[model samples]
Target chain A: MFDPEAIERIRAKQRAWEARELREFLARQPESRADCRTGSGLPVERVYTPADIAATSFDEIGLPGRYPFTRGPYPTMYRGRLWTMRQIAGYGTGSDTNQRFRYLIEQGQTGLSVDFDMPTLMGYDSDDPRSLGEVGREGVAVDTLDDVEALFDGIDLEHISVSMTINPTAWILLAMYVALAQARGNDLGRLSGTCQTDILKEYIAQKEWIFPIRPSLRLVRDMIVYCADHLARYNPINISGYHISEAGATSVQEVAFTMANAIAYVEEVTRAGVDVDRFAPRLAFYFVAQADFFEEVAKFRAARRIWAKLMKERFAAARPESMRLRFHCQTAALTLTKAQPMNNIVRTALQALSAVLGGAQSLHTNGLDEAYAIPSELAMKLALRTQQIIADETRVPNVVDPLGGSYYVEALTNRVEAEVGEILKKVDALGGTVKAIEEGFFQREIADSAFEFARRKASGAEPVIGVNKFVEPPEPNAVPVHKVDPEVEARQIGHLRAVRAKRDGTRVAALLDRLAREAADPGVNLMPVTIELVKARASLGEIVGRLRQVWGRYVETPVF
Target chain B: MPPIRVLIAKVGLDGHDRGAKVVARGLRDAGMDVVYTGLHRTPEEVVAAAVQEDVDVLGISLLSGAHMTLIPRVLELLRAADAGDMLLVIGGVIPDEDVPALLALGAADVVLQDTPPDAIARRVRELVAARQPR
Candidate 1:
């Protein structure tokens, strides 16, 4: 091995050379003050050297697949396997979405990610008056087991992993997924997939929450325990920063707040009498990959390191897998533009590359038309192709943690780790993430960051390619956006009504009542009851509304 | 008079709300009273909120590739209640292909997702200008 001092001296010389070059360049043309801040508004120095990370050691940072996995989670990394290719999908009725799912699988997508309609997301059935005109509009409308079965009609749960992006009714969706697998003769224990059962982000970022915070926490705890025991291979909750970033938080806030939410989940599950090592391994994360290339990459590296440390030190996790942070990344939808719609392909390609370089286990590249509408067939194909190009053509996956020893990247990773730590401390001081949410700390921080970001743009401090800079007049025909079937609502509602009529009404009612009673009892785990209700063909509205009755819905008191 | 109350509800499956939230903040900053119903708000809930809040305008945001089906029902609800005077504006990831139909369903105007915040605020003001007569 090379001498540590010798390596330090070489790095110092390179830093000096960079500083000298920067000085010579600045002497010719002054750099803008705004050019110095990272995308998240953190100040960037002209150069970083060994001094920047003097406190960090090789062991604390560690090698791939080792303790405190700052470099990479797996020893072989992409050499063994590349990140799973996933594209977010759902629209029209269950049949329509099922077709799309089949098409995606045919296109060689390695995994599945389910997107639900607005009515279904908010725990409403297509037959409800409130669901009028909304069914199957944005996502596949799943009101019952029939709809759920239709969604994955031919897809095998045993072979391909699936991720359901629902929170308020995550348990219902999980139950539906389990029932679908069982019907196909797959054992519940053998199913592999993840549910975005992260209620904190729903309340804080997405605002798709159904129950109050405390009860929601209990529900999440129940899923963790149930999944640990039965669906050992399945992930119950994928705590997400994707929505938070999409909602306008900076990269630092994205990682920080998401880590805070993850901590809350770990604490809740631990309190529920589940071992940390049992569920922590399956506790996946979802983050957004944005245009801030290096910082975005650094954020991923820091996230792994922080999670590993937290799991080992805070939770006392025994297994290395339990401490490892496996994540799925989606290119930032907010970065796409409607002006030059096709340009989003290039943007997504760059963001996806960053996530890979930072070692994401799975990725979804947003379509070029994401800024304008739900992705069309052509646009989504382009999105999948973007990932294909990177994986097959670019040879980026051939190396493991390729950016690991760079001075700039290491410094940035350390900086992000420190910044996220500070944010974690703030959340902790507020008596954990739940209390922080009640006190509106997370919301306030995000708003403040968003406000500052907007102020920067307005003041010409930061640049957005299509928005602030590179002004282009709107094109007459940029590209046509996708239009969901107009009759989808009526058709979906009809199906839902038919199913309600055909199902055993007495059994459905009894199961729903049992779910309500179980929900009321904090100690009672609602997983088995929820599974039975979904199996009994109870509507999404009935299940969610029962919880609403027992654990009154939460109303947001906007903190601004 | 109290600030012109406007309710922004997201109907259907559109989760692209950066535009909606930004518009809501812009309107709120512009001194308009805004009640953001958050994401995935059902038509019934949105209409009930509009009726109860006595909102002067109802703005619905949808981008889930589902506008054609969702927007018309919201308008029909208003028309059926004789609350059609409440200036209806639909925004968020709206395709130009469906703009005419949305406007035909009593939407005063359909705001595209890429429309600037200032333009959205200005359009809402124009729609409610006569209604907010002193």
Candidate 2:
């Protein structure tokens, strides 16, 4: 974005300075390492100047809220209204998690994000044998409409935006949510929330899949179509890179794989006769704000620019809202340490700062105690306070895209965008995301990256302050670990049984039969019938089981 | 001598297999025959596979907080199958307090999160060596 003559002058001056002053300093003191690299293994230069970003054009790094939104998504980002502070909370029964939700809201959390337990996430009811000790261990267990109602017991659904972190059973959860709203007579058009129905990421990174690839994509298409028609303000699918990053992908792979999956979704929906602008506006994204501060910021900026270009040129989405890439970011949980637990607080604060500086629309700062288990109440409070401190005290948000024009950041952003383009080209050559997934391409890439990172840390090349460097004696019970009650499984199962015993079994059966019949037909959207099945008290397992009978389950060949 | 056979299994619905896969590859690189059971395998399925594969070491990797209930069940089934001699090594997000109980329940060792893969491979070698006839 600099004038060529100005850049040439700057380059000549930089070379002269390096030759004279830099040579003497380096000869005497020398650099710390032979090479410095970001977490993605991108080389870091000793300094950056106008010459670094000389090749970039002004239009590519346009103003906020404009096309090629490399700066930020909005004209007045956090200055207008701060990013939503959403701490994902779940463990134990729905009511148990609801209490935590209310506690977070009382503690100044702006938005709600639900974390479903394995059973709920995998489409198993609390009573299913597969749900055994896992009913509510990792997250809240939702079996039916009653559990969902209890999960949101005292919360106002209209005002607060909700994000459900579910994949395989996301459509069922959406149905339960819509059923809850419909039963409460809340306006469907006013429901603002996001269902992380991005099933492509499941095969790529998360490893949480129910139906096979094509069928899963079909379910995602059904959700997008249904939500675009009904839930006006709700995001039907949150195309996510968060789990991909958490599963050991580099920041570049995270964005590239997620975008490839997004492209696949857009293609799937459009091929099914849905308009691009119709559903694309409601499409949201989720990414991780990793520990590399400037790299994370540059990654977010590059991600937004890549998405904007994709929407404007590739998909032909006309609406500005369709082109604008809004994302929610969570601080890297893998960075937290089980060794010096308290150090995680500082780590989280800095990571959250990077996310805010990157202009995330919503953010989740991980609890310091997350390395052990679901975080304790005190840890969650500390995590929330970290966000509050950044928003109120840091003054980082006063200017939109504070690091927008930094030569280093701009150059890094361009580099990240280029790397993502290369990866996407590979995904395309493998015949798109599903084909690549079937070929185990994404899985192998992530596994290799994860191994490389582990090797680096193990060899002391990559230093984790509390893990490999400056180690200390294990502090037993340094932080209170949030323990899900052992009796949660039995109680949750009893609740599921009560609901089943009270509801009309025949009607539930008929509704499930209709669901299976409709699921057998590729032309039908399953959301409407699924909602009816949930309203009739068909458990999450029941609905998913019927669909499984129709569509079949997905099993992956081991990659590693 | 034959290479030490290692079966790294994810014995629950938890999908956090990054650690498991890395450890599996690390052990494989360390010259062990490692087989990963992918994801979503139940405790019964895990035990059955351990027996069927005739693995020398059954490494159970659990991050879902279901270890307290699931690990013991795997141990119990191994005993019932008369394969109690197989080395049982636990890994992933186990708390410090739970380590003692797990060890007391006949677990050869409990490797907490971020223990270097090379260290894990060394420990497995020691355990296998100890199990051999003197």
Candidate 3:
């Protein structure tokens, strides 16, 4: 924020410079197009000056690590510590994925982000009738505690943080993780990892709902409370906008919708009698960093500012950590092109840089071949190299907020903050997130954006490098694809059967009955009971199915 | 010409229906009768739906690499049901190496991920026109 005297001088000088400098330039170059816009279709001005940021004040754009942290979340951001190079990975059976996890850790990846296959993600066991042909294709298949144990078999759970990209059955997977840690004698208080326990986003974009909205919110609240009490070093919930963006939301909607979901979570937890600062400090977010470098950077800055102000004023938070918005970001997988798959490497690197510049706390750079298959080992290594290149080679992370004082970035930050605020208000006005979700509000908005982007790409208004332009036919020299073994399904099913045959049937039945009873009651926290069942050797399907009997499966109305 | 009746379905446990829903809308925009069999459908349910809807074209979308295992099953069921003539088109996150195997399993075409909505519409029309009764 500049003083008024300097602002007046800068404004007058900018006008004169524009008049004299633009008169000569406009005659020759004139603007190439009638309008220039960001990915969200927000207008981009020809020039920005100090006058553009004249309205902001010092308090609004406070110093990094201070209240309403506009510049960056922490004062010495990357200087104090490097962003976690967490690569998202998983494939095949448990042992297979464990090797990949260990491989990444050896390649200097700081964190492990787990990806679950469709059956696991949908809250069903591998042997479920509906899970045919999809046991471990997209991600690793976890049917029971045995599978979870094998997935992290040799990998030390304490040394590295694990982030499971599972929802719908997030609570179950988390319970299994806690149980496994306890069985391994790791202190439950020191279990460090993130379970993407964001169920609201599932109903909104991902469409992996196992129960209706209210029950789903209850599960999220239960996890938040349980983690707050038990898992001090763990992040119980990661209110996410990554899937929302992948589902077709623009940057603004992604922020607003994600924040609105966060508010709902805050309300539920606080009303459950958990204090504001109790769980809010550990609350984390997941976002997709699209290709637009400046827009994406501005979105991150604006997100921190908006969240801080909202927490301090609305929820009456008592701590700075509770006010600060910490988040993890990934390069946009939706923007990856399958045409010339190699181009994705460059795209991913650029997006990763944008995230780094935007002050992301942790980041995942998508593999180049992700659009084709689960990233091959070679592709995953290259993805990790991209992060290393950005952090170690580029000198990009040397400063806290190098672009903080720029005219364009600051003005764009304010603009994005205002836009996100407007969308959040709309979500609240529609009787909050759950009411809006039932009405298909978020779904419709995202579908519209997805369609618009698709149409733009189809028409060449938006020229994707290899998709609609400079296209090439399928070549022989393709990225070596990783295929889930054809026998993985049968072997996984056999393993499940063996686990079932060996476990004490009576104890399993009793634990499941108790789980069902607890699930039926509205005043129960299902985490402790879910943990008990998981420890009792109850499978994912058994636990989920028991609750499913009590709270019926969710059948969503198709929005499109 | 009656609209080319199509059943757009997701078989297997792949929860990604964004592509399926978009293609369904695109086909509907092109004036085809599109019936979407929502998420978590089995191959048997998909086959039964195709037979019941009497769709001329059946577009099955899978992003989880289940096409290799699930496609043959759907094809086998259709043949047993005497509906082998139905056009079995596929799309979504498919690898080029598996395209031939899927085609050998009786797929009509592998629609590219970013194909235009009208191109899908046109292809469905052309496929039906070729199979029309004399």
Candidate 4:
């Protein structure tokens, strides 16, 4: 923010300097490329000056911990407490992932994030025919509370924050988590973690939906209300742009689509008579720290500013906490190359640096071998060490929003905010998120962007180190990938069958019937009933299947 | 002649369909007719769709590490249905060690992540051309 006179003088000097100094320099050494753009295809100028951010107001880029927190969410930020190094770890059975959890925690990780197998994520039992050959492969497979208990066996429920990367059956997992905590005599209010309960994103980009849009929103609302009332310290929903970005959305689309989904969720919860402030404070976000260093930083800043304004103006949220936009960022997995896999470590480091400078509250630095499979133990440790080095060795986080005053960053932040606003306007014009999703608006937009990126990479316009530019001979089996035990599926299914045999069959049936009945009534919150069912050892598939009878499954009209 | 018909299918629980969608668009842009069978389709469903669509190439994208189990099943179903003539291309985050196994199981080609869509399209064309009785 500069005075008009000063800005005018700066613009005049820039022109004069460009006419003489830049002309001579450019004549001697012409620019490399005529068209230079960021990863999102935004134009990047030769240089940024004070005139670039002249239009931005000082208050718009306010101090940390203040309203419209473009700088950072908290005042001290990393200076007060380093971001939670929550590396996601899940594979094989529950005990198998539990070992990884203990290993990561012992390796100085501050938080725990679980990655469920397809069965658990899609609300299928490990033994379901659809879950055939998929059990405990991609991530851990949990059939009931017994599996969840084994998953978090030695981990302290109160001290450690757990984030579950489950969407469709997120409510069931939340219910299982609550039941686990109750059985362990842990205080629900003191329990802390996040369930990625953002269902609209599931429909938009992730394509992991069980129920139709309306009923999915209902489940999200129930989780928000249930967590707000009971688990005060827990984050009920992590509105994610990570999956959106990974699914080929540009940086702007990632923010716009996720915020649109966030708005829909807020409306759903608030319309159900819950106050915005009650649950808004616990509303968290997840984003990807992509390759474009400054753009990723600017995107984070712009996202915070937009969200603050939206909460205060649109939703009428009163509390400052409700206005703050806190997020967990994982280094972009799509950017990692399988060719020279070691190069991904450098990419992840730079991306992690961008995330920290952008003021992410929690971070998950992806492993180098992620392009192949889930990271091995050594790779996960390397990823965690990347965060540690950034926090302890690098003094970049010593200052709050270190890039806040940079003209380029501020100008880019303004640009991203404007672009996101335009997209949101289009969504609103299309009758909001659900309506837009129904029309395949988000899907088409993301697919087009993805296609464009693929075309660019194919043509060598965007050079990926090991892929396009610096070509390398194929090295077969160079990187040792972590393989899930082949017997894991059989073991998980046997455990599931054992759990079913042990639990009371009559009570489980009764709970499922009641859950289905309550699910039919739109007024009833499904969390309590779902919790009762999970407590009764009703499997995830049974609960979701019964509810599917009432609220039919969602079948998306395929959009490429 | 007619445009190359390719059916890009995601035959598993993995929802990472960006690769599949990009490849589909690329194939379409490369003057091919591409049909995507959405997400969460089983091997049986995928084989049925491939047979019904009668496409020259069927590209199955799987990222859930279930490729070993799922791809073999798809190959089995294709043989059972006498649709083994269709070019079965496997794509996604498939490991290098498993590539030979997948190829041995009758997969025409195994495309890993970061293969440009056009390259994938070209590969599909080459595979289909080789399969043709010229």
Candidate 1 is graded, for docking, as acceptable
Give a tens-digit lDDT track for model 4, residues A185-287: 9999999999998888888888888999898899899999999989999999999999899899999999999999999999998999889999999999999
What's the candidate order when arranged by decreasing lDDT?
2, 4, 3, 1
Chain B TM-score list for all models: 0.90, 0.97, 0.96, 0.97
CA lDDT scores, all candidates in order: 0.83, 0.92, 0.88, 0.92
Q: Give the TM-score of candidate 1.
A: 0.91
B87: Cα error in model 1, Å: 4.5
Worst 10 residues of 3 chain A by lDDT: A474-483
10 residues in a row with least lDDT, candidate 4 chain A: A475-484
Q: Lowest-lDDT window of 10 residues in candidate 1 chain A? A: A451-460
Superposed model 2: Cα runs more than 4 Å off: B132-134
TM-score of every model?
A: 0.91, 0.99, 0.97, 0.99
Model 1 segments more than 4 A misplaced: A1-25, A32-35, A458-460, B1-17, B28-60, B64-89, B103-108, B119-134
Worst 10 residues of 2 chain B by lDDT: B125-134
Instruction: Looking at model 2, give its docking quality level.
Output: high
Q: What fraction of the reference interface contacts is present in each model, in order?
A: 0.35, 0.87, 0.60, 0.94
Q: What is the lDDT of residue A224 in candidate 2?
A: 98
In the predicted model 4, the residue pairs found to clash are none
